[model samples]
Every structure is written in structure tokens, then in C-alpha cells.
Target: MPINSYDYYPLSWYPDSTRIKRPKYEAIITLLEEDIVSGVLKANTKLPSQRELADYLDINFTTVTRAYKLGVEKGLLYTNIGSGTFVSSNAFKSITISTDNSPAASIDLGLVSSFEQCNALLVPAIQKVAGQQTITQFLNYQAPTGTAFQKEIAIRWLSTLGVQTIPERLSIVSGVQNGLAIVLSALFSYGDRIVVDFYTYSNFIELAKLFHLTLIPISADLEGMSAIELEKICQLQEVKGIFLMPSCNNPTGSILSASRKKELISIIKAYQLIVIEDDIHAFLTAPFLADYSPPIYQSLPEQTVYLYGMTKFICSGLRVAYLVFPERFKNTLNRSMFNINVKTSSLDSEIITEVLHSGLAQQLLETKKALSQEANALFNTIFDCQEVTGHHPWPYFRCLPIPKHYSREYIETYFNQLGVNVYHSDRFVVKSDYEKAFIRVALSSSSSLEVLETGLLKIKEGLVGLE
Candidate 1:
């Protein structure tokens, strides 16, 4: 019997046990989907514990577990660390960005930041690496982690961002995506619970599901992930780790405040959680934020796996990312990298090393910043309601509120008809419900200032037309 169950009920969700179909787990999942979609189960409605639900339904606990796992994968539900499972924040609907650029009129506000405008600045570095006599060394499969010389460049690059670590602690991977795969495989196990921001990187969500790891989203604000919210989750459940974007968040543009960073460091140490610090936007945002603090990895070096990618900031096509792990994770991470990656394209890392060593990376940063500012300024003049603001000045994307009454399909179709692509907030939501609906519009994807402005105007026109 369920611990505190009454005949009437106290559990957050109670299914009609008699109506359950064959294959109990599938039945449970079906019921959950139906209820969530029908609005019988509200978003973030805390469901019973697996054991309790199993007991209530008079079925096996593993059946409920399997059902819950399937539900999570389907985005119908989510679970807290120690707390019971809950309906997904986006239980009512799921949204996805179409990467297809088939439409010639399509102004892509959906593809966030691969700023190829810096490609002009990268030609010298590329030519230098390709033109070298010893370039053949880079073509081979050796130095998957990175050559000693490449690691030296990584160290110097990290120092500019206030992260100081030895060569042995660093690994050169393909990029953040590849580095993330390595960390998840190396440090975490299947079914482990990890905390993420309420509005998280969508790719991370998919990647976590692939690894069979559960993600618990902590609430965040304009200053970034809330420590109090994290403390609450930690108290309620055992979380294995946290995935953070310290410099600037995707879609929302909320930077992690120094005070919040300190508070988070304390809780993370108290709970002994691993930190996956993705500092992809630091190069762009750090120079802009006057009160910018050092990355969380600086404080919790041993507990953090720092990923610095050259994707958005410098060289996007290079597909090179520098990963710095603590001494403890070195051996395990190396083995995992070797097994999963074999090698991370030494040629790519070499090109990035040249970009850094030649000081072209800094020039790229300055050029990109000027372009970002131009794009943001253009966006500001057209859309007056644009709320996100900081010294960083809208790195690549900004979020705008959508009317609560509009459906995801209706809104997306609205923009699609207007020939612009924007990502809905639901696309990035983790476990919890968002207080309001919004859309993330990218400033960097459009080819020119005029194209970006046209997209912005179309967005504005669409909003007005919808109203």
C-alpha cells in the first residue's frame, strides 16, 4: 500500500487502475500523455513516487520506473532528484526549430551564433596551418587529447579568461558538443540525476536523454541560476552534477552573477557535484561585462570540467574545443575520449592553435563584437519591447514575450509565413513550467544588418498582425 494514501487520494496524480490496458508500463505512459495533453495533469504537477504509484496501481515498481523513463524521453514528464516525478513544463506542446534553409526569403533568427563573419579574419590562420611543412603531423590520428604545443596555446587562452590550469589537466576535443559527450560518458552513469537551468540548452537535453541521465532544472533569474532554488533541489534529491553556461545563457542572455556564483560553489561543494562549465560565450561577453567574475571552474577546479569552444567566438568551421578537467578526472576522461572519439581531428585543433598563437583570435573577437553591437542596435530601434539588456549588449540572441493565448504551432507558423525563424521558449524549457511564453530571436544568423532588420520588422509585423 502507498505510505499515506487514502481511499479518496493525496497523491498528485491518480490513474484509473481498472482502465489500464495490456503491458502495464505502456499503459502508464499512455495515461500520462493523455492526461497531460488533455489538461487533466497541469504542467509541473508533481506525480507520485514510482514505488507509491506502483503500489496504488497494484503493479510492479519497475513497470512504473520504465513508464516514467519513457515519459521523460517523450518530454511528457520530468523528475526531481529526491522529489517525485512531475509533468513536463512543456507537457502541453513540444516545439522544434527547422534547420532547413530551403526558403530563399527565410531570415534565420533560429540558428543561434556561428558568426561566420569572422571567417574573413581566419583565412590567415588557416593558410598558415595548411601551408606549414609539418602540417602532415596534424593529419594523423595521434594526440587525440592534444599535442603539448596545442595544450600550451589552450593554457594561454584560458588565462585570458581567468582560468589557470596545467597542460596535463587539459584535453583538446572537437567542440563543446563532443566535449560534453566525453564528460557525460566519463564521469556520469546511466540514470544519474543532473541539475540544469530552467531554460537550458536544448541540445544538452537531448544529449542527457541519450546517456539515460535525468536532468533536474533549477530556477534562474536575470542574474542566472538561482542558488536558493538549487539548494532546495539539492536538499530534496541527490544530483550528480550541473551543466552551466557561466558567461551568458542561450535564448535568455542571463549572465551568472558573481554573488550567485559564490553561493552555487558552496552548495556544489556541500553536495559534491561535478560542474560542466561551458564558457562558449565568455570571449564575447567577458570583455563587455564590467563586473564580470571568474568562471565557476576557477573556484571549484577539482569539481569542474571546463569547456571552451572556438565555435561562436572565433572559428566556427574549425570545430575545435579546449577542455580542462581536474587531476582526478584525467585518466578516466582520457580513456573515454579514446574509446568514443579515437581522435578529435588534430588538424582542426592545429588551425585553432594557429589562430590563437597568431593573435587573429583577438581580432576576430573585436570584429564580431562590432557586428553583434550593430545587429543589436538595429534590433533595438525596430522592436521597442525587447527586454533583455546588459553591458554585453545582446551577444547573439534575445528573448521576447509572446501572447499567452497563441499556440506553438500557431506562433511558429505565424513567423514561418512571414519568412523568419524564431525558437519558442518551450523548445528550451527543462522540467518546470515557464511563468510566461516567449520567443528567442537570434541576431547573428541574418547575413547583413538590413536582413536582420527586415527579420525584426517581420517579427514586429507578425506580432501586430496576430494581435
Candidate 2:
């Protein structure tokens, strides 16, 4: 096999030749599976030889061989000694293909462009860091906790979160998702009750489901999660822990107030509940805000699990989010992670640290603020309809309430047809709700004001039609 042959063959070539818009091997498998299931290729029907198929399809022999293997795996075909592959007897039973042609869509709400810009600015710094003779330190297995410099940089970054902690309390993980997984794995078992805000980060819901943790949704207001409700739930159930996004809470764009934070802390202390503070969107808050603290548990450090993702503010591609354990839980969390992933990539840590120290993070944040303001302005202008209200001009996203009669699915479909994407209220819901009331329009850092305005106009047109 030529080294560059497969690499050189454009993905478009195979699909074009086959008159199949799907991936080459996937299409071949689909065709074979269909034939077998329909009895056009009977149970005992011998498949064309790889070379024959290759010639017939005007493609490479290797492609046909791969397709056959895939078909065999799907029980559509089987091979016997000295005989060619034949359709399996149970081929029809295994021929289930999902025909879900759901539209491919995404909401342009995240401010990850700032992260990308920071990453671009840090490339040289990263190269310089790697060029150091100490680069060998990263090549070998890194410490379970992370390197000293990495820890130092992480601590400095954590300070920005208003948590003044030593490296001992922090363990660097692959990313926020990994950190959440590790924390969940260490703290809770199946059927354990974990409390979360009604409108919380969607991924946390997924993580809770994966771990089989019972997610008890706490009610919330503009100041953030209801401390009283949380207290009630903690008392009623043996709530193992609480997962919260205290600062610039996602989807809702609500910031938990300082007084509310204190109250929540007191309640957690009373209930002795472990708190997982996902401050991923912490840095986006105006630094001067008196109530804003990057890590919510800076005061009650012990019972709090502080998760800070550098990716959200600094660089998303870095895949770095530290879990600052309350001093007592550090050893246990470290051990749990080691037993699973062994250690996170030292290279990523080094790169992230280099970027942080280079002042690129600050520059990126400034740019983000400016871009967010512009995007928000565009959002306001585009959705100026009387029905479209409740949009707080936050630099990141605006929440608009839908009419009682309108379904989120219908709105999403309408926007998608116009090449605009909007997140349905259900994306933020911890528990299912029949009424699709709110739609979140994120002012993405990547999108220009003109582009955003165009998208928003389409949304307005869609809503107008609905009205």
C-alpha cells in the first residue's frame, strides 16, 4: 500500500463515483446490508470478490475489503474457509439503520473565539517553553498532581477566581468534563442525590445521568439558585453534593449575588453538603463587580470543589480545567484520577501555563468584552419585536421568552432553515418541561455584528410569521 494513497484520495472522490453522498465504506455497507435484508442477496448469496467489487465500483480493492469487514461485523455477511463472504442468515435481523435526518445545527452562543485568539497568541510562547531542555520533563510521565511550574501557574490563575489556594489543593485534569467526571466518580455512587439548579449546564445533567446520580433540580431566580430551596432539598434528601455554576451561570446569564453566596454557604455548612462549583464562565464577569468571585467557595474552601476551566476564558483547545479540592479531599481526588486516567497531558499544562504567564489571557479577555458588547447590540437591534423581550444586554447571550403557543422545536426549525441556530430552552432544563418557553441567543465571539444581525433578522422574520 502506498503511504500517501489513502491520504491523497479526497473524501469526495469515493462518494461521487459511487453516486452515494455518504462516506465510502459506510455507503457500501449500507447497500450490502439493504440487499441482504431485502433478500435480493439471499442468506447463502456469495458476495462479489474484493477485486471484482473494486473493479465494478471503479475504486481500490482495499476499500471493498474494509466494507466487507464492516458488513461482517454488522452480521450482514460472513466468510468461511476457502469460500467468499456470504450474506448471513440473520442479516435481516441486524439491518437496522437509523434514518433520522435531523438537521445539523449549533447555537453560536459560546465566547470561545477569545480562547482561540489567546491560543494563537500563545503559540510562540508554547514553542519557546517546549524548546527548553526541560521539555523532556513533559515527554516522560508527569506527576499525578502535575508539575510544580504548572501548579504555580494554575494557582495564579485560581487567584483570578478569588480563591487564594496553594497547589496542594489543586489537581489538573484533562478538561472541565474530565474534572466533573472524576469528582462525580469519587464523591457519589449510583442513586445518590445531587442537587443542581433548574437551568444548569447541560453537560452536568449528562454526567449525572452517566453516574446514575439522582439529580434534584433546585429552583432559581435572577440572583441565581434559591438558597432556601437548596436548603430544603438538602434536608429532605441525603444530598451527597451540589453542582452549581455560581458566576455568570450558563443559558440564563444569571450571577449568584455575594449575599446569596454567603447564604448558600451557610446552608451547605448546615447540611454538611459537598459543593461542586463550576466557575467555567467566571472570568467573563466584570472583574470589578463586588459580588463576583471566580470560585464561589473561597470562604468555605474545605467542603467546596472548585472547577476552573482555562479553556473558557484562555483557550478551549488546551483542554485544561483544574479541580481545586478542599484541602481534605485533595488526596482522595488525586488518587481517584490516577486510578482512572493515570495523569493528564503535561504538554497541555505547560502550554496553558506559558500562555497564562505571557499576558495573552488578559488581552483576549479585553477583546472578548468588546466583541460581546458589539454582538449584544446586534442582538438587540435584530430582535426588536415587542414579543421578543426579557433579553438582558449581557455581552455573551440574551434570553427571549417564546409565546405559550410556540414550540421550541418549531422555532429552532425555522431558524435552521434560514441558516441561523438558536438553543431551545430545553437545552438548559435539568428536568423536562412540556412548555418550550425560552430561547437562548448567544452572541458568539466568532460572529461579526453584521453576521449576527443577519441571523437575528431571520429569527425575527421566523417569529413574526409564527405570530
Candidate 3:
């Protein structure tokens, strides 16, 4: 066969020439697996010619040929004698399931670095405290409620959001989800009514369903859930409470406007309803917007519970989230915590406190802001998405409508093929007639500009292809 005519050249053809160290055969196989899993190596895509792959990887031609055979044996690739090697249709599905059983690889994109990077500084400071005689207190079982110092940090963090609260009034939970679960358990009996925006966090919907709570979808304008509609629903239904993401709402990324917040607060207060505010994405916004408080906090009666997760901004592994309750609900929340898990993790609390004290918290925040800015710029360029009115990149969840005929899933699949991960709008919709054929790109995770640009270009190519 003529070398020029051969089409089964392996992906090794695109190797970086300056990389003098040859990748192990296993590493090469893993690379191919990732390409397949991410959708880069699409189903039925043909491998390059063995000679071409060898030249690309700067390895012996036999090595390329052997690697191709190995991939086939592993069921990642298939070959016909004359037709050439093609990616197996089920390659990624198998890999996805196997990944669950295997030890995690080093480059898991789902992993976020803000908290991990913060803990690198925190661990030493904590060790210094551990060296003290009183450190033994940390190992022993103690109060179901957090210590005064932990509460202080929680208060300080909340203060940044313009919420004022005392230690006695707060209950430190295992994490935001735990806190959410407890609130759901406490507030709603099975089949109670709850209202949320049409495109709110899916977790809220899942939780409501799990708890047997009836969820009502509230209509939303560009400013977020409409106050008039929310009031009308509350008057009509026996709503126990409402779950909301008033700031940088998940999936849709709509920031509830100040006026909308005020209207919601007044309506909820007049109806004497419970409000569960999920402010997980609050800190990701620009610093200038830090002081913006949810109207629910200011306008609602004392029964409202405001929840904030340090995990999203810090690290998911930390698993620490604090909730500020109305003064009357402190006893009730504390009892719920004791009944559920007895207490939050003191070790996690200490580590988080160290991060806050070491100034790394602020540094990470700054780093995140910068990263978000760069990612947003890259996203805008790649999609050529005219910023929809009221879209802000750093703190807001930005949605780009998928071009006609292109489903959000197709865009997701296309990006996955290019080694990029992203979410579609359907991930956030609860109950509504709204069409969700849009991409919801999150900029919270730290990524290199080069990687961002490469991913964006691939997305742009996919979008252009749709046109």
C-alpha cells in the first residue's frame, strides 16, 4: 500500500516534537481512551496510518502498529482488513463505567483546585495548633453545634454578604446538601407545596421529589422569578416554603435583580412563607457585587433560612457549609443537626478556618475572578454570542442559546469530542414550558488560558458547523 494513500494513521501523528521522552504504550492507550471518552475520537473515526503515527510520535513504526492492535484488543478500536481502524461505538460507555471502579487518574477535570490550593497553606497552620495541649479536644466527640470560633468565621463570611448574625443563631452543617436535606425534612412534610423558578437548580427539584414535596414552577423574566406571579401562586397554593438561587442562579445564571428581590421578600413575608436561599455561587461574582444581599434576607419574616456553601468557592472536598437561621429557628436547626449527624466535621472546619486566616482565601478568590474573566472572554469569542441583556461572566451563570437545529446535547457531545466538558441548559430546568436548547458554561473551575482557548475554538468550530 502506498504510504500517502493509507488513512489509518494513529493519533500519535499530532505529538509535540520537543517531548523527547517517549510516552509509555499504556500512556498512549490512555490518551486514546480519553480522546474517545471526551468525544475527540468520535465513534467510527478512523485511526491514521501506522507509518504516519510512528512519524508523529517519533517512535518506531512497529510500536505504532502494536499500539493500534492493543487498542483493538481492549475493545477501544476495531479494524477491518482493508477499511482501517475505527473507534468502537461503545468505547466511551465502557470507559465511563470502568472509571467508576478504578482509582482516579491525575487529570480529573471535575476536581477543582481553589480549596486544595488553600489547604496546602492551611495544613501547616493547623499542625501548629495541633501541637498545643488542648488539641486533643478536637479528636473527642463534642457539641452537635460548632464551637464559638467556627461560628465566628461563619459570621465573618456572612458579613461579606451583608448578612449580620451571631454564633448562637447559626448551625454548621456537614455541607450545603446536608443542610438542604435537613431544611427540607424540617419544613415540609410529604406532599407539601414549594415554588421555584422555571430554570432553577435541578438538585432542588430532586430533593423536593425525594422528600415528596410538591414543586410549583414560578414564571421568570430577565430579572428572574416574577414577583407578581410568585405572589399569585402563594395565594393559590398552600406553599410551605420556596427554594431559590437568588444570586448567580445555577444553570440559567440569572441574578435576581434588586427590585425583584424586594418584591419577593414582601410577598413571602406577607404570606408568612419559609424561604430557603441557596447562595452557593454568591462569592464567584465580581468583588463590587459582594455586598448585594438577597431581598429574602432583608424582607422575609424571621422564619427564613439562608444557606451558603464554602465548598463551591473553596473546595468541594471540604464539605463545610453554614446556614444563618432566623433567631427563632436556631433551636430547631440545632436539634435537626444533632438528630441527623450529631455535628459537622471539626477537622474540616479547622482546615477551612486556617485557609481563611492564612489570607489564601482572598488570594484564591482573586485568582478565581481573573480566571473567570479570561474564560468568559474566550467563551464570547468562541460562540460569538452577543451578550444577552444582563449577562455578567464572573458571578453570573451565562447561557448561550444553541443555534437552531443544534440541540444542547449535540453541542455537549461535540465539545466532549474535543476534550472539553460543559453543561447544557436542561441541567437546571425544574418544571416549566420553557425550551432549554442552550449551553450553560460555568467559569468557576480554574483552567489555563491555552486550554480555555483550545476548548473555545473547538466549540466555535462546532457552532460554525451547525450554521
Candidate 4:
């Protein structure tokens, strides 16, 4: 192996030989990360072959392999099946939804706002809950799965969205994200594969990484995620579950139709995949669309954990949502809920119950819907929208497709520099090979109507010569 040092070829990365630490693998990752963060190695740059790197460094090939594996796990790199390993598309960018780092007057078009204008509508309910004689009941440490009264309210709140579920089968979690954590922790083992749409909620993507779950990215059509692709993936590998936002998918606003649901259900049944239905936005869309497909949970109740989030519609600060699961998984879900969340605040649950009971929740939904309409209309005036699902009730975010020339990295930083904080499509991507790109602009995030309008217009001006 030491036959010829003269035959060595140049590497994409030239690490300083003297700088590598004793344990070469960790040092390799450190230097690789340093190079990536410093911008010396750009996104999607293919790295040297593992064997070639090992030979160049005069170390065992397994060390380089371990280093490359660690790099992928760290989100600093990704590998295409046949193609060699390369830097992750999101390696150079920091994914976040906060404006803490943005300069003053920065219009936030990143975080999906719940249209905070509707929060004022909940004041009466909060006051009513505070005045009740039984207010101290919520302070008790009992009812980890919510009190009977709270579950009754959950049933009533769910009924509005056409969901039929009894108190025994339902659990009140803090939010959809919380329910998701319980499901993943209680059900799935590490390294389990789950299928997802090409582009999805960025938070979910990070959550999967945290749990070490492999996400098999599937292609999407006019109707959400494709069934044909699901079949192909199932045939190739074992997928434990699937995550879907069938009713108004986040970031893209794609909705799955009835016929398409049947197609996917067949695949789910054949594969026996646990369906994690995030119907968080159904309340906003179902009332408007007469022909909206019913939640998949209804068809496969035995194999689904349906989450209905009230954050975007009622009150985001309350951090309240509901989850309905089958009786078979009750023990595991309950145990995980107890371990992860000692209890989802009964105080927050009570206020939400009062809101639902007093009919303020309906008023809040209507007001939020009206605000959503105004925001969508404002977005339409500035940019052209290609309708994804039929009779689409504009979701909180809009996808603005861009030319290939507008790299995802540039779109993010450039937008922030122009006083707008938006996210590139790559932020929501799982493992897509699609060439098209876009940025997801949160229409409902701004403080007032005028602020949203100003942000959208700023984006239009920024695309002057790029488009």
C-alpha cells in the first residue's frame, strides 16, 4: 500500500495532515464541519471517495467510512444511492423560525403565525375561566389525559371538524408537536424508516433527525404525496409509518383528494404502516370546501394517531391540541405522555374548553379565516399562485416558485438582508432530487395587514432581475 505516494490525486478537501488529532475520524468530521461553515466548501460539493481519503491520510478505510457516516448523521452531509457523498443542501444555512436575530422593522415571512389578531377574541373566555369557582380544580396534579369535562370539550371541539371520537380514545396534548413526540417515542424504535412528502414541515424534519428515524422522501403531484411512489418504496424497504398533513399540507398547501386517499390507504393496509395524520389545518379548510376528503383516520381508525392542532386557529400561546388514537396503543401512549409531559397544563386546557363552550372558538375561527383570506389576497396581488389542490382554501403559507438561478442559500440570506425573514423550500425538503426550487412565505405572520403587504412587495422588488 505504500508503493507509490507519487500516484496520489488531488482531493476535493485538502486537510492539513499535521492538524488532524489522534483519533482521525472525529478530527476529519471537525475539519469538514469547519470547512463547510466557513464557506470554503459550498453546498452539494461532492467529497473525495472514502478509500481515496484513507489512502491519502495513510489510515484504515473504516475510519474514513465512520467519519463520513458521522458527517451525514450530523446533517453536514448527504448521500445519493449511486452518486457519491456530498455536502447537505442545508449545511451552510441555519434553519429557524424566530426573528430574534433579525434587525428592527424586519417583516417575518418565516414562522407560520396564527393570525394573532384573533387572540383578542379569547379575552372573554379567559376572564370567564378565571372567575369560575372550580378554577382551582385545574391546579390539581391529576388527570394526565385531561379531566372528563376537558375531554367532553375536546369531543365538542372535534365535532366541528366532523371528527367522531369518544373521551376514552382521545388525549389532550399540548400541541401537534407534543403528540408527535409521544407517538414516535412510544411506538417507533430507532433507525425506523418513515415515508414523507418531498417537501414538508421543517420542524417535523428536525424531529425525525432527533429520533434517528430515516425519512423516505416521496414525490408529490397535484394531490399531495403520491401512492405509486409509496408502493415503490414499500417494495424496496421496510417503512414503519408515514407522516401526512392531508388537509392543507404545510408550506405547499397541497391537499389529498378522496380518490387519492383510497390509493394510499391500500398501500398502508398492504404494508401495515401506522399513519400519523396531522390534520391541524382541517378546521380552517373543511368548512369552506364541500368536497374536501375526510381524514384518513376515519378509514383506518385502528392504525392512526390523528392530531388536531388549535394553535393556528384559536390561541397559539396556549399551546393546546388534541390527539385521537386507537384503544390498542392506549397503554404506550399514556405511559409516554406521563413520562414526557407530567401533564399538559390543565389551566390552558380549561381556558380553551371555556372558549369552545362559550362559542368564542367559532368566532375566533371565522375571524382567523377572514384574516387568512385578506393575507392570501394580498399575496396574490404581489405574486402569481399556482393552485395545488382543488377549491384550495389558502393556507397560512404560500409557495413562491423561483428560477433555478435563485439558489436556496442566496434566497434566504438575501431576503433577510432586505428586511424580510423567509424560508427556502430546501428547509422543508426531506431528500428530494427534484430540480425545481421555491421559497415558502408566511402570509399570516405579520403584525398588521399593512406589514404583510409591505413584506410581499419587498420580495417582489428583490426578484427584479433574478426572475
Best-fitting candidate, scored by TM-score: 4
What lDDT score is found at residue 16 in candidate 2?
29
> In candidate 1, which residue ranges exceed 4 Å CA deviation?
1-74, 78-104, 385-391
**Which scores greater on TM-score, model 1 or model 2?**
1
Summing lDDT over every window of 10 consecutive residues in candidate 1, give the lowest-scoring window: 93-102
- Tens digits of per-residue lDDT, candidate 3, 12-119, equal 235333443444454566577666666677777888777776666656777777667656534467787898877765354321111243223222222223424334
Ranking by lDDT: 4, 1, 2, 3
Between the candidate structures 1 and 3, which one is better when assessed by lDDT?
A: 1
Weakest ten-residue segment in model 3 by summed lDDT = 94-103
* TM-scores, each model vs. reference: 0.83, 0.72, 0.70, 0.85
Over 1-467, each residue of candidate 4 has an lDDT whose tens digit, in order, gives 52236345667887666677767877887788789878889988999888877877777889989889767745678888888999987666655455566556678888887988777878888898899998898898888788899999889777767678899999999988889999998989766778887877778877776676767778788866889999998998778999999888877788888888999999999999999999989977777777876788888989998999888878778988899998998999999999999989999998888888886877887888888888888787677754544435678988777775666668878988888988888777765344478888898878899999989988898777466
lDDT of 4 at 22: 67
Which residue pairs collide in model 3, if any?
8-47, 8-48, 8-49, 9-48, 9-49, 10-48, 38-416, 39-417, 40-417, 253-397
Residue 129's lDDT in candidate 4: 89
Model 2 reaches what TM-score against the true structure?
0.72
TM-score, structure 3 vs. true: 0.70
Residue 405 displacement in candidate 2 (angstroms): 4.8
User: Residue 406 in candidate 3 has what lDDT?
Assistant: 57
At residue 442, what lDDT does model 4 achieve?
Answer: 90
